[model samples]
Target: MVTRPASPSSRARLASARGTPRPDRQMAILLAAEKLFAQHGYHGVSIRQIAEEAQVPLALVGYYYGPKSELFHAIFEHWQGTIQERLALLQQVLAGPPTEAFLRQVVEAFVRPVLVQRASTEGEYYAQLVGRELARQTPETHRVLTEFFDPLAHSFIDAIHAARPGHDRARAAWAYQFALGALLHHITDHRAPTLSRGRNQVCAPEAAALLVDFITAGIAAVMPLPSSLSPSPTASPSPRRRAPSPSTTSRRQA
Candidate 1:
């Protein structure tokens, strides 16, 4: 028997099997840039490094994203979808009564996506990148981070006020900040198991739920009603004792 030449379809299949399908070049560059930018501050990473990490030509990074700033912006845009999910859930929550339970749901909607992303390999890098951006807090990166997070934060703050009509709005804002601090802490340093010496641990699924609980309770704790808003106790008149006092005086004199 003689060996036969492979058909076109078989050849394509062989090529595909021999190598993994590559992601879109632009997207790969952004992803690689994000991981590097997160590991090193934006100022510390170069287009060349991103290209090398992405396994693409140095010129391709510039061709796709133009410059380092634009490449960084692309990472922000990539996460826009996640922000949209948060906003949609927030709108849905706002559509209903702003009860405590609903507020917790809103908190879950805001934070769960971020924590869930950490559970995946790619997402882990993204989360680290976000945390790093926060730490660096240069004027440009600060503006970029704020542009994405501030609007979402305001919506939640409004919902929190609606949930407890009498709660202090200023305190509620502080609570929002505190909640963000907690999330950033988790993202940058997830060493709970080490801290507890392995007695306590938080898995990804549990992390979201626990965070919702912690933040919701924290908000509730901080946002107490002002005295003006609190219900006043009813005042009662003192009982009349004049007659009894006079009788007792007379009896003592006799």
Candidate 2:
């Protein structure tokens, strides 16, 4: 979401509209919006239901965050740090000389931050919200992805091309899209544990490693790495984005 935080005066107006200022009010509204929007599609949630979920006046939801679309945009805006961190990790991997682990590191640079988010209490709802959005194809879904995620998606596809010269960039992009579907399904679908008879719990910490395995293998199918590369110690994979705590003030506004 390109939406940034409101100014202090804007916050004052938001609080005044509610007839009381509570510092947690805006964040509460965002959390509620994230949950409801994830469980229900964008069209399915109403501002009044969000207010009820957050235990705030219905008017406060509008004053604090505006309409449903704005609230949806705010969720991605609130997680803008995630996009930045992913970019930073990608650049770090590219900065190093290419190595045996080059493609795998590139995939991790893209995937780990999402998994880190899914594992956190604060980010779980948001992760599911993102999952819902990614699974759809509408003007709003296209807008959100194009505005907030397309740049990142391009960066990763370009990196994939870099790792395997002569691979068509368009194919690389499709590979990225496929990997994203698998990643999101891991978080949103609970059938893994059932299918595996409890051996493949998606919420378990090791599930993250499993996701990387599947994604890296899938990417290799699209952009096959050379058979003779050697691993380099300099190319360590993960540069994780630390999840925010409950009191962690958002870097942007709702």
Please state every model's RMSD to the true fold in angstroms: 19.1, 8.1
Off by over 4 Å in 1: 1-23, 97-100, 199-203, 225-254
How far off is residue 249 in model 1, in Å?
A: 75
Pick by TM-score: which candidate is best?
Answer: 2
Clashing pairs in 2: 5-253
Native-vs-model 2 lDDT? Answer: 0.73
Q: Write the per-residue lDDT of candidate 1 for residues 1-254, one digit (tens) a residue.
A: 11224556755655643354344766778889989988887899988899899887776566556668877877877778877887787776656542336657768877877776667667777777777775565766766656776666666666666655565656656777888888777766767789879865644465667888998888767865444443345633222111011011111100
- Candidate 2, residues 104-131, lDDT tens digits: the string is 8988988888778777887777877887
Give Cα-based local distance difference scores for all models.
0.66, 0.73
Instruction: Candidate 1: give its CA RMSD in angstroms.
Output: 19.1
Once fitted onto the true fold, the runs of candidate 2 whose alpha carbons sit more than 4 angstroms away are 1-19, 226-254
Q: How well does candidate 2 match the true structure, expressed as C-alpha RMSD?
A: 8.1
